[model samples]
Target chain A: MSLCLPYPTLMLVTDRHRSSMSLRDAVRAAVSAGVDLVQLREPDLDDAEIERIARDLIGTIGPRRLVLNGRPGLAARLGLGVHLRDGQRNADVAARGDDRLLGRSIHEAGAVVPDDPPDYVQAGNVFATRTHPDRPGRGLDWLARVVENSPVPVLAIGGIDASNVAGVLRSGCHGIGVIDAILAAADPTVATVTLRQALDRAVRDQQVADTGNHTGILGRGTMI
Target chain B: MTASPWAEDPACLRAALALYLVADPEQSVSGDLVADVAAALAGGVTCVQLRAKRLTDLDAYRLAIELAGLCRQYRVPLLVNDRLDVALAVGADGIHAGVTDLPIEVIQRLGNGRLLIGWSPESDGQISAAAADGAHYLGLGPIFGTATKVDAGEAIGLDGFADRVCHTTLPTVGIGGITSRTAASVVAAGADGVAVVGAILRSSDPRQAAWDLRAVVDAARGVRAG
Candidate 1:
């Protein structure tokens, strides 16, 4: 089976209003920063608006990977991937005939894997945060369980930062899903580069571990 | 072959489930694997996803064709995962794609209505968006936790699950770590169906396990309806 891994970077699209950073910019930033996938999450946008943004973003992403949150029909219309916050709605949408990449946001171990296994799960609120303050955060321990139990790749979101990105990956997550870290940054590109660097370093470290060399640190050696 | 097992009819989904029987050619999945699926089918599995992960594309294609034939005999639909080429070559009923693979729209365009498409949802927003997008149906879960999906999301509790369901009108099946004991709870939380792998695949008697799980789903749904 093709390996199911998390998007290398996730850019939660929202307007910050300095210069216009539309969905297109979000896509551009993600791509420029080496994001493997980009999801358009304008929950308040109308179908036409979503359609417009999706259309524009698609051109920018150019087959990198674009997910339209909660609008499978539109996603299908645009031939984009669909990410569902709720699995049931996604199932119903699929039943109606939009067969695509259906993903959901899972906050716990038993959140539900759709009958049709999804491409991956975005598990989050890994740390306490300003995003979705109403919900409690799921710590790294809980995140680890999610990583261990899911049938698909789990992308950890909610309060993820460059500092903790390595821990999230080490906890068995396919990758980290960033929100404010990217969207809320002064320079999304810089933030993204830093996070990507950390993630890349983790991968390299993992490789070393896999190669049976665990007695040394990433850059430190015992001098053979 | 036969009509798609995921018929438009909600009753059709509940009447007979599609049972997936996975066997890796490199490693035998155990004869009991078939027995579990058979029992589940007997108990009302209307369809099956024969995912032979270890086989080559050609071999998987042949195996899918064989399994499709068996499903036809049993009047169940068979779906292939991530193998659009094999699915098309085998003429199976549908295809299921993960986020990393082909999008549903591509699947729909390629299938030309002959194949039903299903997606995986990990969050409520994803589910809501997917419902609006017109997916064939969704696989909601890793309900109790499972090792099968190493990167799954946090476990949304039953309350959280119910909350997510409030957003859509689609028929859904719960997946991930589902078992007889937890199946009823998932159904009670408003899942239209329950999909299991190890619960039946790794069982001592897959068939019997399938039946038992089905019974729980049916019973729980009935209670909710009543």
Candidate 2:
């Protein structure tokens, strides 16, 4: 399947409880530092609070790049994307048509991106993320394997930060999604900028290795 | 309201933009902004802007809910002024941002085109720039001097207001001090409608005031069309 979004991208998986700053500030700062996508994952708050946070976030970064976690109906209503929890095949949300993106979380090695409705899958505990501390990192090798056979681009998550993000990007995953890298940092802008630079560097280096030209890597450059 | 058969008509924008209300809680005669807005709606306000500076966030959200509900029943659109959070939370139709509010270009990029965004630009440059800035409508004015909003810019008057209106094709609404007396002149100045505050709320009879203002604006639109 074709990747519809920008690759070698950075996504912020926002956790309000873990953020050192307000989630809104963190998301805004991260977007300013080139975080291409935001996944609003705060499930504890009520729907009203979630929607307020979503709008505030949208005002900063806009709605096209934001995805609501496990809130398909709300996401659909806002004309934004939705991220499904593990093993949810909610056809109703997926079939709502072409204007929105549908994302999924997967843990198994045998899993495949569903083709009926094009989707990108976020796979991890790639490196022992704080959000899921108990699960050991599945490692970059597993990530490479996932990218190797996966039908759609994969966003690696879990404990992956600027320090370890390059290795994750080298695994051929489309991008990385992190929580503490931006949210819990002393300054989210710096944190996001660091991660963004590292991710861009890694992708640049890989392009050099691939064919000595950035344009040589097929499907790696297109946004749509 | 409905985007159906009228969506094909160019006047659809004018119809929605005409007879607009800039509903402010601080200026409400009865201290009940929701009821004030409902009265204006009954008097044929085509659109409403919930502009609150003194109320708590919850109060504003509650009022937005009531006003949005009223606008829904009346088949007019309700927009929240400068409070994107309140607007989004209450599921209002749009946001009316000022020159200093959240940048409209960012809203256009990230908003996924969900809310009907309205912006006020006081000059020719801003009005021209607004064409590319994802503004669905332009709140252009101080068409006549207004005391309700003390900080409003100097009155653009009829001639200056008309000169700026020609710069953009977006549905235009003249704001800042429009009243039954001056509302028709705003429409005659090329604005699709008129936006007012004290004209509706501070009046002895807000519904009647709105009815008079709506009629005046409609007649001017007819004149301009003819």
Which portions of model 2 miss their true places by more than 4 Å?
A1-224, B1-10, B223-226
* TM-score of each predicted structure versus truth: 0.45, 0.48
Model 1 segments more than 4 A misplaced: A1-224, B1-10, B17-36, B223-226
TM-score of chain B of each: 0.83, 0.91
Model 1 chain A is weakest, by summed lDDT over 10 consecutive residues, at A215-224
Compared with the true structure, all predictions reach lDDT values of 0.63, 0.75
Candidate 1: share of reference interface contacts reproduced? 0.00
Alpha carbon lDDT at B197, candidate 2: 91
Worst 10 residues of 2 chain A by lDDT: A128-137
lDDT for B210 (candidate 1):
59
Candidate of highest TM-score: 2
Give the docking tier of candidate 1: incorrect
Give the alpha carbon lDDT tens digit for every residue of B1-226 in model 1. 4445453444444333322333333323465344444454544454577666667888787777767765553445577877889988878877766677787777777777556666776667877887555566677666667756556677666776677777667666677777788888887887776766777667666556655765466467652110
Q: What's the true lDDT of residue B61 in model 1?
A: 78
DockQ of each: 0.01, 0.01
